[model samples]
Every structure is written in C-alpha cells, then in structure tokens.
Target: MLTSAILAETGHAAPTVPGLASVIPFVILLLCIAILPLIHKTSHWWEHNKNKLIVALSLGLVTIAYYQMRGYGIAHGDHATDPGIRTVLTVLDHAILGEFIPFISLLFSLYVISGGIRVKGDIPAHPITNTVFLAIGGLLASFIGTTGASMLLIRPVLRTNSERKHVVHTVIFFIFIVSNIGGCLLPIGDPPLFLGYLKGVPFLWTFKLWKEWAFCLVVLLVIYYAWDTIAYKKESKQDVTLDETRVTPIGIDGKINFLWLAGVVFVTGTMDPTKPFLGTGWTPFPFLRELLQTAFVGLSLVSTGKGVRAANHFSYTAILEVACLFIGIFICMQAPIEILNLKGASLGVDTPYKFFWATGALSSFLDNAPTYVVFFETANALTHEPGPGILQLLSGHFIREDLLIAISLGAVFMGANTYIGNGPNFMVKSIAEHAKIKMPSFFGYMGYSVCILIPVFCAVMFLFL
Candidate 1:
C-alpha cells in the first residue's frame, strides 16, 4: 500500500494488529457503561466514579496482558529504538497521549472555564424562549465547543424552566441539538471533526457541511417548538403563570472567562502540530498544546471568582467520569479500530450512505472519535492512491469529499443516539439529573433517540450522504 510505503519512507511504525478476541474487553467495557447503570442492584454502584475507574482500568489491564502474552511483552532496553517497544509506544501514544490527553485537556479547559461563567436569570421558559436558547446553544457549540456550550447553557436552561412541570424533553432535545447535532461545522465543534483537523484535514474545511447542519437544526428546532408548545399547554396553569410573572433580566457571571474561552478557540484553531496555522509545524513536542491548554485552565480558575462556579452548580464529577471512562474506551478500542483499518475495504461499505450508517452505528456504541478514524481509513482504503482532495493530510493520503462528509456527519450527528456516543451527552445527562430532573434510563434514552433522531438521519442520508 502506498500509505504504508509512505510511512516506510518516513520511518513511521506500522500498526500492530491484534487478533479478533482482543476486542472482547472493549465490547464488555462499553456494555458495562450501557447496562450496569440500568440494573437495580448495580446502578447505584455504577454511579460512583471510583467504581467506574476500577472497571475502566481493569478492562484496560486485560488488553495489556493480552499484548504481554502475545510475545511483544518485554520492554527492557531503551523503549525509543526497540521494535517491541515501538508497538507499545505507538498504541499508547495514540490511545493515551495522542488521543486521550489532548482530548481531555480541551474538555477540561472548556469544562472548567465554562463552569466559571454562569447565566443568571429566570427568564420565562416559554416555548419560543426555550427555542431561542437552543438556537443560541447550537451556534455556541461550534465556537466554544459542544462541551462548553452544554456546560454553560444547561444551568440557565434548567433554572429558566424550573417552574415548568414537563422539562425532561427539553433536556433531551438539548442533548440532541446542543450537545451533538449543533457542533458539526468546525473542528472545535465535536471530537471527531477536531481529530480530523488534527490528523490532516484543514481547520476550515468542515464549513462545507453547512447545508446539512442547517437542515438538521431547522428540522429539530421545528419539532422542538411544536413539542414544547404541547408540553407547555399540559403544564399546570399556575406554573405557566408563575413562569410568565417571574421573568428576570439575564446577566452573566465570570464575564472574563469569555476571553479565556476565546483563548481556547484560538489555541485549538492555530496550534496544529501537523500543519500550524501561523508557522512551521510543532509535531516534535506533542505536549505543547496540552501545556497551553493547562495554562488557560489555570488562567480561568484565577480570573473567575469561586462564587460563580458555585452558582453554576459546578463539580469535577462529570469531567472525572468522562476522563476515567474514556481512558479505558481509548485503550480497549485499539483492536476494533485496527480491524477496521485492515478489513474495512472488504466490508461492502463502498457508498456514502453505507459509510454514513456504518460509521454512525458503531459510533453510537463506541466512542465516535476513533470510529471516525477507523472509517476514515476505511474510506482511504477504497482509493489505491491519494486523490486530489481537501483531506490533504498525513503523507498526502486523503479520501474524496463525498466520503469525508458522510463520515463526518455520521460521527457528529449520530453521536446523539446514546449517552456514551459523544463526551457531552453523558455530562448533560449528569447535570440535568443533578438538577433533580429524572432522566431516562440507558435504553430508555435510546427510545427518544430512536423515535426522533433516526428519521431525521434517514432524511439526511437520502438528501446529503
């Protein structure tokens, strides 16, 4: 393969493929996330971050042991030069350092910084007003990131609608529109696209999917308006009247954090190691981005008053759970992703819609970021050589525009299908549950996704993919 040939020239290490059985731990871990929380006995136990960490690390260790037994175990000498150590380093680099650290760093920065800024008001949670808020969230998701927009908006949204009886649907739609569907336009919008940007795709290229973004948002917004109007009518007359009479002017706490948020956007937008926006690449030192992000995290903490985070009902638990679960998710997923990279071309996923659904279906269960990469390489596999395309990325290996759009939309949009699909979905769920709103169970949440999201995605597949 020319891709491998190019890597050979560049002295790049080829991936060490694990056998099929190795993927079991990955599947088991994901299933635990989905099922354990549903069981009456285990559900309470699963809520603890410590328990989640145990599960994640335990499963992760199983994979490491598998590698050890496979005769690629020993790493005694200098790990930098040894071939045995190369596999360990490359996989770890991809799973932990390359993928997880930068991933969690951005999320941490956004989560911590956004938590500093709180929207203060009890605006009447009229259907139109709620609709407007979601619209704003959609816009903010792309700029500040879905996690940032979700963290910033969920509190005010819940506070505004606190007077209403039926607001669970609002939160559900928030997860769908704000947390997932909204962040499709740019690298900062979602994890998968951001990763694509990092790997080789230009930062600005995703703006090409605006039509798909517009259609999904318009449709979801219309449905939400109609649904919320009905729900509002069902609310007790007293609650509606109370909401109307108690409107307060909205104000922002921690306004300085907006500058910090801009700093985050700027760093992510400009500081690409593979292709720097300003100057020569900085791929040699990968930690530079994480270092800058950490600085911003500290800046945000110092700049914003502690009182503001309290008002926002901020806690580390949400980010901590994400951090813990994802370490395992990234580690366990190596086998499946590698399989996709190798056997992807023979899978009959030759068309755009096939790529859309295949990537999306797996993304709904697995973490969408690596799912995007697997299918991305799969799409790259169809072409024997890099074609003239926008993906002008690593070693000049790129796929066509149509295939890239399919995978991108599939990853970003279908991530709304489940709690674990994208990073912010569970965080939104956690925050909403903490607000005393009873969210649906794991499979229960899927009910909402199945009914509302699937049809819209079908339409997207037909029209766009």
Candidate 2:
C-alpha cells in the first residue's frame, strides 16, 4: 500500500504483488546482518561501512532489478528496462524517494545538530540519578523525538555511568525507554504516529493514548530502577566510589543548537504536504522538508563551536551505517509489505489484542511505519459502513477506537523489540559500541526484550490494550 502521493505519481492504483519468493533478498540481508557479525570469518569483514555498503546495496539493487524484470518498476511494462537508471522506475523508487530521503535527512540533521550540543559533566551514577536521567529522556523524547532525544542524551547517560562495571543493562534499558517506548505520547515522537497524523488523524487525537504511553513508560522505568539497583550493589567497591566521586557539575555546551533542534521539530511537525499545517499550504515539492532539514545540518556544522563534539567524541559513522542498511531494508522489504497489504485482513486479527500483537510482531522486524499503515488500512477495510464493534474516532475516521489505540501502542512501543525495530535503536547501539561498551548481538538483544519487554507488554495487553 503506497501512500496516495506515491500512487498518484505512479499513475497506478495497485501494482501486481511480488510473489512470496521475492522476500528472499530481504531475508538474506537480515540473516547476514544477524549471523555475520558473530562469525569469525565475516566479523572483521563486516566492520567497515564500505563492505557493509557492498552487501547492502548489492542485495538492494538485485531486488530492484528483480522488480524491474517483473516489470513492477516500469510504467505498465512487462520486462526490465535496460541498464541506465532503470529509467521509468515509477512506484518503487517513487516510494523510496518519497520516504527514504526524508527519513535519512531527519536523522542526519538531528544527529549532527545534537552532536554539536554536548551535555558534559557526569553526576552521581547512583540508580536514582540514572533513573531520573532516563525519565527526563523519556519526557524529552515525545517533544524532541526519540531520535533527537537519544542523540542528545545517550552520551550523557554513558558518561554518568562511566565508572560502573555493570553499565550494559543501562544502555539496553535506554534503548527500551528513551529510544522506543517513551515516544508514544505524540506524533512528533515517532514516525508511525506522524504518518498517522498525515493520514488525517487529527494532530492531538494521539494525546488520548497517554494511558498506554504512561503505562509502558512507568513499567519500563520501574524495571530499570530495580535492575540498576541490583547491578549497582554488585559493582566493585572501587568502581562505586569512582562513580560517586568522579562527578562534575553538569552543564550544557554549544547551547545555540537548541534553536536548531527546535527548527527541526517545527519542520517535521508542520511540513506535511497533505495537510495545510500551520498555514503552510500544500507543498508541491515533496522533498522541501528534507531540503530544510539538510539546511539545518549545514548550519549546525558551520555555526557550532570548534571541538564542541569532542566532549562527546562524536562521529558520523553511526548515521552512515543507518543510511546504508535501512535503504536496503526499506527497498527489499517491499515484497513483504505488499504481502501484508494484501493479506492482512485475512490474518484473523479482528480484536484489539490481536491487532496489537499482529502490528507489533511485524513492526519488530519490518520497520514500524509501513507496518502501522498496512494494519491501519486493514482495520479501515473492516469498516465498510459502520458495523458492530466499529467506533467513529474523534479525528473522524471510522476505524474502531480500540483497534486504533492498539495499533498505535503496538507500533510505537514494540519497536524496542530488536536492534532494527526503529532507526534510533541501531544508532543507540552503535554509539554504545563506539564507546567501548560490549553491546549484545542481534539475537542477544532480543533475549533481553523477550524476557523483559514481553511480560510488560502482556500486562499492558490485558489491562489496557
């Protein structure tokens, strides 16, 4: 299910769905990502972004070529276009150009601008201090976005716990709280919610999800507090002392970037071409938002004080890796996306709980934004003219309220289930790894999510979802 703009650009309502076999490139790329880093032979080879790019783009382009051969990329043709640019690559690249560039642009600007503003100085590494810090991050996330908040605060969190021997759990929980679950409160907080807003769900209608958002946030924060207390007790006496005494008065550097950060939020929240948001009217150019965001990136780069990023030891490698990997993931995953678009309603997901888990399960792997859209459309399809169990929304969509809430919570919260579940998850992990932290492998991380997040989500399911 491409967006209306994409469908309009393609001049086609429905392209032929790729066969299930077309999912092979995506699955192969995912397996390579999961297993390659653990293998002795490939571990070193996968370290360089160049090598990663080779595998990523090779598989991505192969899928593109396959789609072309299948004539899915051509304008109503039945064969692949020869060499040069895949010239009439309409719907496929149209979707890519529409989403991918903006996706990368938003991340790039947030990352670069946040990198310039250093949150220097370490406070006590006590569990309470870290808990409060994470809670602050959770609050910031909804306003500044999970990606923005993660980029801004991750270094501070790492620095606060620099002396602790048991800091891995803190980072993992950071991914849980700050990077994923915390962003459920508002549209600007996560991509899926923003997509919902663009689809004509009222901007503040999501504010009603405060219950589910608070439930998950409080649960995760409580778990993190308990977990950190236990780990703190187990730390060596010397390490604990260093944590307590090595603290410096916390302060902000490169404060001007706050203005730039606000600019990003404004652009993201109001630049929707589908809506006349803030009286901007309909934008004819799809990439205008991205262009403005890139402008912010350029401004931050030139205006930031020399060596401000030195405090955080910032690098572009994390953002570069995300760009490389998600381009492939986004393109190759289209087969499965189209599959879900076609078959989602037949999956026996009729109730609220079913919608929650179904949307969430796919969001855990396929990236949440499109998954939410598919399920949203599926739920919409169920409401042909208002039947039993159907409820009109405040935003005026007739999608059952319970199902919309479930889908919203599922897409926003369950994105923490894996490294690739959300963009910021990988960025957080990458930054942690660069700081010399031994972050868990892909499956290793899911082990944490399964044992911890699953139970919390289950409680949420019964009590609220």
Candidate 3:
C-alpha cells in the first residue's frame, strides 16, 4: 500500500499490517472476556459487586497503562521520518470519536439522574407511566443523543421498577429501544449517522432509517408489552400487596442543573466535522467555540458537585472510564484503520447490501464513525469518476439514494447488535448493573441481541436498507 510504501522510502521502519499488529490487543481483550466469565462463575465474587469490579478494573487499567505508556513513544517513533502514523492519528483523533457524542451525552444524562432525591414508597404503579417514559426516552435520545437520554432516564426507570422481583427484561428492553435503536431518525440521533452527515450525507437523509426504526421500535414495544403483561399478571396472581402508605416520591436532592446538562448535549452534538456555521464572511470566534464546549462539560461536572462532599467525583467516574477504555481502543486500533483504508478497494464489496452489512458489522464493534468514513471513502474512491458532482464525488459515480440509504441505515441501526456496538450500550448496562439490575454478561448480552435484533435487522436489510 502507499502508506507502507511511503514508510519504506522515508528511512523509517515500515509499519506492519494491521492484521499482525492487532494480535496483542485482541489477545488481551480475549483474555479479559475469558476471565470475566470465570469471575462470574465463582460465587465468591458476584457480578453485581460494582466496588469489587471497580477495584479489579482499576488494577487491570494500571497494568495496561504501564504497557501502553511504554509503547506510546514508539507508537509515534517514526512520525518524524514517516507521516503514516501521524496522518492516521490526525484523522482519527478525538474529533472522530466525537461522532459518538450522543452516546456520551446519554451517560452524562444518567449521572445527573443518579443524584436525585429518594421518593417515599407506596405510590400507585401505572404501566402507562413506563410506556410513556420509554416513549419520551426514545424521543429524547434522538434529540439530545441516546446516551444523554438513557443516562437521564435509566435511574428513574430503575427506581420505578426497583421493588419488582422481575425487572431484568425491562432494563434489557431499555438498552435495546432507548439506548441504541431509537437514534435512527436524524443525524443528531446517533454518532455514526452524524458522521455520515458531516461528511456530506445530507442531514435529512437519515429519514431513510425511519422504516428500520419503526420495525425495531414496534418489535421492542411488543416484547416489552408481553413481558410486562406476564409480570403484571404474576403480581396479580400472587396477590402481592404493596405498602402504599410507605411509598414516597423522591425529589431532586442535588442541584437540578438542567441547563448545564443541556449545554453539554449541545456542544457534544453540534461540534462536528461539518463545523456548522463556521464561516459566513464574518469574524469567527475560534477561542469562544473552544471555551463553550469546555465550559459546557466542565460546568456540567462542577454543577454536579454542589451538593456533594467531593465535587465532580461521580460525574468524572463514568466519563473517565469511557475516556480510558475508548482511548486504548482508539490508539491500538489505528493500524487496523489505516490498513482498512489502504486496502478498502480490494475487499470486493460493492453492493449496497454488502456495504450496509460490511460497514455495519464492523461498526457493531469498531468505532462506527470511522467505520462509516472508511467505507464511504472506499466507495467514493472506487472510480476516478469524471465529472464534478457532489453526489458523484461521494459515491465514486454510482451515488444512488438507495445506496446511501443502505449505508446510513446499516451503520446506524446495526450498532445495537452488541454491548460495544455503541458507547451507551455498555455504559447503560454498566450503570444498570451499578444500580443492581442484574444485567447479562458480555456474551450473554450478545445472545439476547443476536436472537432478537439480528432477525429484525436482516428483515430490514431485505425490505429496506
């Protein structure tokens, strides 16, 4: 490839292909996956033990950090001589990950929810309330981003069903509908789709996802209704009596900084490759732009500290964990990304369906934003297509709306396929577990997704995407 060829000419050690470089991180990840099940199998250390998992996770993180730091200098060692790493890193930096901001925003919203006041029990339980909340949650996820909506609502959703002995299905359904599948209507709804829009795919182009969104939404709603009905029937059958007198509504205990949280969503959603409203022959406020985003996240965290002994303590934990894990994944995955881009044309994938599933399946685990770009750029680079049309330039001459739609829908919709498919999926599961929801394990989660999401996704691929 040109990158490797250029590296050889630059008098630097040529970069190895990603397939080879990926061995170590993949191995480490596999080991983690294997060990987690063992940890879960032992009765001594329950999966619900957040603090214990935190301790173990912290130790693992320290070790990974040590090795990563040792390799860090060498990561860019050839930068001066060869620009390959720099080129790849420059293109794949934090800004690329920003495509998943909606997912991140979802987490921020969740953190805000955790500090709310504890309501007294004995309140009347209304199934309609759960339905309404989930509906509102889906709408909010689209607008504010999925992560934002999930974080804000998950705690309350859990609290509403907290007393119920059977609620794992509720949390699972939430992750499926609210956390992942709901963000399909607009670019702002999800990061991967947003990245596509920023790269020249139109903002309104995402409406193509409506069909898939409707399908998933209907299926999930039906599942929820059925499960809730059975659970409700059981409660009735058992004649379970709640102490209504003891029930109380929990008010917002901490400072209800709704506006600050809104600011975070705005900055995270609007800051993009498109650089909205950047230039209009008017003086641009570059410094102000940076400040607003910084202040938005900073002020949001600061606001979270007002009622607590330690400020920014809880706010930082989830964000910091996401930061660390994603950082490692991003940095280590660079080689693979570069290679993917370099060899994209030769992959023999040229159909809309192939591109859809190819990009999506990768997006399921890989960072979807970059995955979208790589596939889009690959499709674009397919032909030295003659004329200068934006559509032609983008899709390398065969830029049909249907093709674009497939790519868009696949990248956005299939992201719900696994816990790691999108940022908030795992975060929601983690937080739900933290709230003691008894969520499934990584592979266990996959089983649920495969059985439910896969069939529906294939149906969409056949019918729409």
Best-matching candidate per lDDT? 1
lDDT of each residue in 1-465, candidate 2, tens digit only: 224333333334444555878899999998988999999999999988888888988888877776656744432323322322343244355347756776778888888998998988989899999999899999889888899999999999998988988999999999999998888888888989888877766678788888877888888889899999999999999998888889799999988898888998888877765556575565535666778888888888889877898778999999999988988888888778867876677889999999999999999998888888889988877875666756664356678778889999899889999998889999999999888999999999999999999999999999996
Q: Write the per-residue lDDT of candidate 1 for residues 1-465, one digit (tens) a residue.
A: 112222211123443445789899998998898889889999999999999999999998887666545644222122222334344555566688677887899999999999999999898898999999999999889988999999999999999999998999999999999999899999999999988876678778889989999999999999999999999999998998999999889999899999998998888777765564476554434566777888999999998889999888899988999998999998888767767766677789988899899999999988788899888877876665655654555557667778899999999999999998999988889888888999998788999999999999999988887
Number of the predicted model whose TM-score against the real structure is largest: 2
Local distance difference test scores for all models:
0.84, 0.83, 0.59
How well does each candidate superpose onto the true structure, as a TM-score? 0.91, 0.91, 0.74
Q: Compute the lDDT of residue 116 as modeled in candidate 1.
A: 94
Clashes of each: 0, 0, 19
Weakest lDDT window of 10 consecutive positions for candidate 3: 113-122
Error of 3 at 105 (Å): 8.6
lDDT of 3 by residue, 1-465 (tens): 113333332335644333454435533543453355457465344333453345434543443343333322122235322344534434234323332243444454445443322222234345555666677777777776776667666766776665566777777778878877788787767777766765666566677667778877877777677767677656542333552333566554344456655665555445543354543444423334334655655655565545441311233455545544554455444445666765777899787888888888887777566677788777766545344432542222445555566666677777777666677776677667666777777677778878877888788878775
- A best-first ranking of the candidates according to their TM-score comes to 2, 1, 3
